[model samples]
Target: MGETSDDGRLGLFGAVSISVGGMIGGGVFAVLGVVATIAGAASWAAFTLASLVSLCVAYSYLKLNAMGDNRGGSVSQLEEYLDDASVAGMVGWTLLVGYVGAMAMYAYAFGSFSVALTPPSLVDAVPLGEGLLRPVFSVLAVVLFVVLNVLGARATGLSEEVLVVAKVAVLLAFGGLGLWYGVQQGSMEYGFEQIRSVTPVVMATAVSFVSFQGWQLLMYDQDSIRDVETTLPRAIYASILITILVDGLIAVVVTSLAAPDVIQQHPERALALAVEPVVGGIGFTVVAVAALFSTGSAINGTLFSAANFAKGMVGDGLLPDETGRASADGAPQRTVLLLGVVAAVFTAYGSLDAITSFGSLAFMSVFGAMCALAVSERDHESVHPLPPAVGAVGCAAFAVLLGVHLWNAERGTFWAVLLLAVAVHAVELLYFERESIVDGVEHAEDLLVPGSG
Candidate 1:
């Protein structure tokens, strides 16, 4: 780990890596099929749209970070700005649920991609169907990562390089081969009319926003980064630009080279299937391995961070005190174990499409709310009016589109996640009613009394 004072040791390279690594995980491989089903040959356009929205969200985060020295993310923002403990608790719980859902999706992706590599003997030995084994494997992956986290295993720079570089290199290679194949086969012009509707385009953009989630990770490192004002924005812009180019190329290549039915049928393995036209059977192994690495690394990092996040929430009285308990090794073992179990259960029960949808909506809603808060505050002298305005409006629009997509396509999952969010907040209210009320009053007093904190 890089040592630093209150200010960070990370430079532009570190910031960019954080942005890219946070994104470009199981999301690209898993959500590609979903977007492909929605936008067909124009999936690249969906990515472009999502990139625009990500840029806007990044703007809001950067603006907020520029105004403060603290590194706390949404929870901090809600408490400091909104000054309402109930709101912060609700948003914090929602964010936690979203992270868990994403973790489940990553676990599911790991297991699904590992299917091709599973030994035939092992596969045959299973009494249940092949599809049934995925959940088991998914649960195992979550448990394994949880144990590793409890052991204080962290993704060092070398590990990050191996994980992020290898996956990006391989995916870029696939994109190159697929692009060449598309050009030679003249499939680029094969399906223009299929991109007729706006609803699907907006929906695809919203879901694919998950692929850009990591860009905001840099925001949390604000205190550490050198030249916070200039470096932060530059890194955010550059990382998003790189992601846009890479993801756009991959989307275009996949939609051009593969059949829509094939992608839809195997959304989790769509990239693997898309690569077959270029490199044949071995290509599947290549993409599948990349998926495993991507999802594995993502699970490790998110699991470690989520455990700490749970502890932070407990410190703020947002969660039950038991969640913040540490084991003998000084790990947030309780939260880690609980998160692993919840993620495992989600993997077993939830579909990728449903999980991705719920995660996307939760993140988008959080970003939108943050942007709205920034706009309402309007105290930051450095921030311009346009970016926050655009971010707030864009986030709201995309969130609505996402909601419509859920209502139209995954209505059952939509309602289930909705009730799940309410249930989470309901528990928060029942368990922490006094704290919530007290915190809210104190927050209001702090705002009114000026320097009371």
Candidate 2:
């Protein structure tokens, strides 16, 4: 077993904040409306089901972290256990693309909320080109964060702390007020009545899975945490449990406040409408502003984590070395820039459903891979076969959900995401092979020379 040497940086609270911040980002506010269309008022139930699946996946991650040298998270675990550079590279690549899709989703949410708040006169006042408002602002949000990250790590961390606290506070207040109103109207029964068949709820789980993406962020902090063994599992459980409760309550509150049809039509602005009856226009404004902050914080946190992940891949020699270069501020400038540009392009063009599917599937696949790894290595001393086995089954259940979604929907973008993933692995195998061989030859030479030079 290994121990953690704390540099007095992140305590239990800090760790929780990182995970919560990453998970809560634009997900609830942005995707809730879409989920409403799927799961009806049972959207909260969908959130609960998705949380269960994510919890199962988290079990595999905790086990993997305990057994291995405390270094990287999922990607590291894959590299160690799978022992295949091409496989690890594919996982890493999918993760990179997933983060990009997520950032684009957040950016899209930011633009949608920002545009909703804009005055009609002001929108018309801008005599600029057509279809430029949301896309322009979305790209601008990406650019702003890229610059913020390039400023340095300290600034980024501090911003996340502030944003996390603020957004959570706003959500708590909103949830409390909405809960009070629901009680007054006895809306719980109505919410229950909205529940339909199992298939829509399952599909909703697949889409809403994006909201829980932040739990993996905790894995990235294994090295910095104070107590590696105890603190890691406790922090992850606490954050996820708390998120599930909070998210469930909020989902119930929103559904109680507004009809499913209303939320579906205004998915982007549903939160504002949910609290409008209780708090009036001020409530709408509050929820809207909170969403803006929520989406922005999500973008910021993802950029920070995604850049670090890319840099780690560079360290592992999975990616081209140049993309990992640091700038004056010690940020992975190249990777950050690349991610920003890609997110910008996606934000500018991709629809919300497309972005959500891409991000959700990418993460769902990663969780599935982790579970499979656990099952494969269950014979290890620290590993158990059951939870990983169960987790693998849970992941497969969600994959079925994805498949159903594709079959019912248009299927064009689904095919694209699948093709893109296949292409990434194929290219990684061909292009990355030469570098792996050179690395192997160099290692062998060093072993043979033994400082002879």
Candidate 3:
């Protein structure tokens, strides 16, 4: 964690920016249309519900952070309290995979928006056709960021603050202008009428939960924060509240500006398309550019964090030492490269919906597990069981809802997510119990040597 200030400490505003930046990343740009498609006129409701879940989860995180002196984040907390390295490693792996999913989604959005903004003549001149263009651009974006990270060029402190502020400003401006246009055109009523059925809204909430996972990144940067007990909680809560407002507002404005079918048709570029009618080409350009910047920055930030996390896990003996190897400039080049390659594969092959679903489910699982850990610490004087208990139950219900929704609508994606989860846990188990398994194999081999017996 690079210091954001001369004193190597973060103030309230800086802390809030980190949380806000984390939450506001490419998530809304990538997942907004999916939410609108599922929740329709009730997209705002879905975002609200999702934020409530995030709030509960955030409470558990805050409590857990306060209970510990180590700034090693969730993995450390899990190992410390549960006294089980295996469980911690599994959760840590899931968290890392989730971050990769997020990077893929961001890259996907960046490519989609960039391609959408390209001239039709140029696109038609290309031999690869439209289908391959997005993936090509996505992979290129991933490679670019990976190279940047390897070169130790990153947005930190003031630059990061400026980037986040610009992102929020763009989003708020688009939402506000779109809302006004909808009102002038008498489209607000139609938008209000689209809010039908609670099931789809709840399902949308499940899908949208990934957009809120960024707030948890703050847990890993506790060392850079000043007055962890006072500033951290306030920053976390304020950031979430602000994100909820922004997400809900955008949902309403988008639903108002465009029909569900329209958004579904171009889920990746929904925001730009939604505002094109009222603001014309200029509006589309602005939104598309914003999406590009937002997603690009997201890829950079997430890649950096995930690489450092892998290095940290290596230090803790949870991962192979090779992953922790740093460059002469002190960058985790290998981990960054590894993560970037995997994220590129995901971007090149996975759909926005599937990637979003997988990411949301992964984070929800980890958050639920963390809440369960919090629940187990009920004896702590400062730890209240009710908040974390509710969080655990809510996360469980949302995860089930996500599974049911995916199974019913996209069975292939559902299997992919499940298979990925199973594979991660299996690898964790194999890595942890390798010695015992090796010993068992040797015993069997000895028994087979009848002459020696």
Candidate 4:
């Protein structure tokens, strides 16, 4: 059933939908309020900056993918070029964690928008307060998607195509109508006047980097894509460019529709609230519904990708082989459940900003490493080193800014993220040295048992 001929593979439209769907799925909806709070009227500029860096990284991916037919994403690329299984394993771990964080962000947005849409009386009647309900709903969403993934219900083929079209249409409509309304009311000019300083914009760019990461998912699905050489590049570039415009438009329109303080106060439901001025209660409902759909799709798509990624890692000997066991249909049920549980924990404990920051930082680190690899391997005539060099430097700089922003604004989250990173690396190290570790454990058991050996 997994076998497919070239005629059955995805074309340019499908490939573009995958990339666009990945990027626009939940990022813009979840991070709008955070960006508005940080960059004020300059939020669009921050998105633009982040898109530029994403473009650079996309270039690196394009070049690297051209060099080989293997499709393990960054791990495969690193293993092939650097020839270091350890580094590849470490990056794969980080990328997997980053995907989990992304799913957490999606679940958070889904829960937030869902809760925002409920009637007040209904919400009030619940035993749990609104604060607790959000996470409860978030965890439930994760469970639902995990179940779906295990059942082999994916957001690909025609399903993904429809979702991409509907999502882009809804977002474009909101942005366009909001912008028109703002201009009609002179709010657009006023909003422009309220733009923040450069530092905040830079910080916002770093915070918003995760939104631009969906395109990277395409790298993992290379086999399903037709004409991988030509179509892949076109689809990746087109999707990112489209996402950039969509993101910028939404940021401008949202900031113009509401004040920064107003958005900050309701970061999770910022889009719903921001659009309320343009179309009354209907706008709120529309945005909330859109968010639910977007976030739901994002969760399903990412969960599936992450599960497959875990399975691939196991195949590569990066993860415990037991985790690679799959269902009859070849679904990595164990890893799917594992990723879902971790994502639920993240959603339950982490704030939107914290999750976004961690996810963005994790991806930035991976992208930077990839870009550095591209630069290091520039001896090939087809690879130009300049763009990747810029990408590496840009990602490094933004990662630092993200750290500073988090340390100053959310010190607790900063420490939590740092601890998580350290833990991921430690796990990677131990996994690589598992044989020695096993031997040491056996020796300890022999000593303790006094002749068991």
Candidate 5:
């Protein structure tokens, strides 16, 4: 592990890998199924729009990463941009809602796969329901991921790569199945327009936006990157581009091949329907099992990165010293335990509506804040090609969609959490942090010594 007086900055490639792991999960696999219902034949357009929108925010994050000089995402970055501890703590809460809630939803998703793999009769024998093995699998997945992460960052990265390959394979297979089914039915028209007519496409894009999340993982190890200026941008761009193409391929092919009626009739099983006519049971098993893991990984990765970054923020005097106390092996044991309990509580009460709603809102809010930061910064400060205005547009667009949805949004977790975060920060900033401000100053020197890793 890299080390310094404070912490080790991440390398460019490490940032990129983390971003890929986080972004490529639930947003692509589980989201596409839901989107297929709203978008029909135009699913590709929604995905395409989502991709463009993601880039705008990506620019915002790059700008934020460069300018405000914050390394941890949402929470730390918000403090840098707004210079308000209350807002920063709120950012932290929103982030917790997204990451922790995701873990719960994805855990339930894994249980769904368990039922898929076995017979309904066996599922009926279980406690939750006749067919809800997903919750069980979710807990197992969490335990497994936590263990891998505790082993160290390198272990988590290596294990995640294998999982990622499996995830992409599932997506490709889903597309091929849909394409084959569409061809057999003599109705093969694979294009983005069939589902997106630009206007309604906006809603679809907003939903798909979640699929491209996790780019902020770049900042988890702020001190770890060898060259943040060149490396961070490249990592964010490359990961987004790859994910966009993968999502597009799956969205278009599935919608085109599954047929509008089939998709609407069994939206959740659209991938299965596409494959039923071709590879039979094998294809069905592949998609169901793979999707379960893919989504689960998305949730798992988010929690892992956020917890690690929280430790960093505390180290920077941006948070209380209690947050920085870890075990000898450097595992933030208390933080992880707290995160795990939160995740499990959410998992036990898992609901897709809640997960997507809050995930979308909190995720976009962070991006919007980043855009505000990016735009406010002077150009002499950044090498970004896109202006802060562009980022702002992306940010505003996201906030509007979230506001409209918030009225009936099932994701009230973020708002509730936000209230708590504000209270916590108020207590700290108003009472506890002045003494640490000087400590923070002394620690700033530790950040200057390069190659400490």
Candidate 6:
């Protein structure tokens, strides 16, 4: 339910759940293949490193929240302080781009997962080939998810509960089956240095760290929390801790049972393959179903947050008013649609590689902004486990990684980012700076809406 006041209502458990749902979304599936290709035997270690980095970022957010009343969360708050179209605004756009791409990929993945799990009879009934079905299914998946979102937060929350339960069960079953079968066949061994590789391991760890980025989503829903101070920090830390343990366990089981060759061969089939020997017919089905649910939620969360984020940009004058229009529930229904449409178009064109290249950089840039803003906002620094110094390091690391990502991956996409930044600046200069009386009045009215459950 939406909150009455401008404050949040999400409890500690709710905050943690939101992060968990966000982190496990499609990342768990897509990221697994990438990391396996990179790290091989050291995949688990890479994931662990990634988790630690995510936790570092989380701590930065906690400090930011503690510094002042930041009901606006990361991007919004950054937009407020940093020039909305300044480097700060570009950073927010970067993160939003990542969310947009992630949404598209997840929607596209729905069809691929169906093809892997659906029987031949169902495949034959389809007029299109498997390749064609993927884009069509992707578009359809986006539509269905949007409809569910429009139904309201309560329904989405219920869907999340079911999805989370099914996901956890499948992962656990897959892990158990992998451990048991591999051990029974004398193929299992306990080793100390599971991670020995260099660059590949580092890359895999980084990939896993990004996939677990959803913990920050809770901070956006500041108005939905019952107690911001207690819930926000606790929810973030707890969710990351759980993600670290669960992801490590999954990677370990998969790596031990199925080598880099197997995972890379059918990147989409790694987990299913890992448990097939032990769980046999049923286990494969279970794992596939679970993967579907997890990624689906991830996609949903991305869309959910992206729509509101765009409005945040608009409300702050970074985007157009049409993009910021809200439904009765105060949700940015139009922005959500815009993001979905953009993502669907990208999905339809098989632009995943290009999107991926730009997407990760965009996300990291915003993360750096969050850290940078945290450093700027906080006055009381402490020597606790997570402090401003750590956040400062986190910010620098994120920026450096973003630069490396931009320079190394795809020059075209990096150029595209530069162009995007210029366009953002032009918009800010032409429109955002000269806020109209109508827009400002409307924006103020938005905050005055009484929360009706």
lDDT of each: 0.77, 0.78, 0.84, 0.85, 0.63, 0.65
- State the displacement of the C-alpha of residue 163, model 6, in Å, after optimal TM-score superposition: 2.7
**Model 3, stretches more than 4 Å misplaced?**
1-6, 189-196, 326-330, 442-453
Decreasing lDDT order of the candidates: 4, 3, 2, 1, 6, 5
Model 3, position 173: C-alpha lDDT score: 91
Scored by Cα lDDT, where does model 4 land? 0.85
lDDT of 2 by residue, 1-453 (tens): 012224555667777877887777655777787777777778888888888878878888988878787456778888788778778887888888888988998998888778767776777777662257878888989999898887763434456667777888888889888998889977753335545567777888888887788878777766677776787788788888878877877777887788777886667677788899889988988888888888887787788888988887887778888787632234588888999999999889887777787788888887888899988888898887887887788767776777678667848767766676677667766666877777888888889998743
Per candidate, the number of residue pairs that clash is 1, 0, 0, 0, 18, 14
Model 6 stretches astray by more than 4 angstroms: 1-8, 79-88, 121-128, 150-159, 189-194, 326-328, 351-357, 377-379, 382-453
Return the TM-score for each candidate structure. Answer: 0.88, 0.88, 0.94, 0.93, 0.77, 0.81
Cα deviation of 104, candidate 2, in Å: 1.0
Clashing pairs in 2: none
Deviation from native of the Cα of residue 453 in model 3, angstroms: 9.2
Give the worst 10-residue stretch by lDDT in candidate 3: 189-198
1 versus 5: better TM-score goes to: 1
Tens-digit lDDT string for candidate 4 (58-113): 99988988886565479999989888888899899999989999999999999988
Best by lDDT: 4
Question: Model 6 reaches what TM-score against the true structure?
Answer: 0.81
Model 1 CA deviation exceeding 4 Å by range? 1-8, 120-125, 189-196, 222-229, 326-331, 431-453
Q: How much is 126 displaced in model 1, in angstroms?
A: 2.4
lDDT of 3 by residue, 42-99 (tens): 8878888888878988898888877876655789999888888878888898899999
- Highest TM-score: give the candidate number: 3
Question: Local error of candidate 3 at 338, Å?
Answer: 0.5
Candidate 4: how many backbone clashes? Answer: 0
Candidate 5 whole-model C-alpha lDDT, 0 to 1: 0.63
- Candidate 6 per-residue lDDT, tens place, 263-286, comes to 866665577777777768787787
- Candidate 2: residue 424 lDDT (0-100): 61
Encode model 1's per-residue lDDT on 72-138: one tens digit a residue.
6788777877678878887778777777877888888888887767987888888875678888888
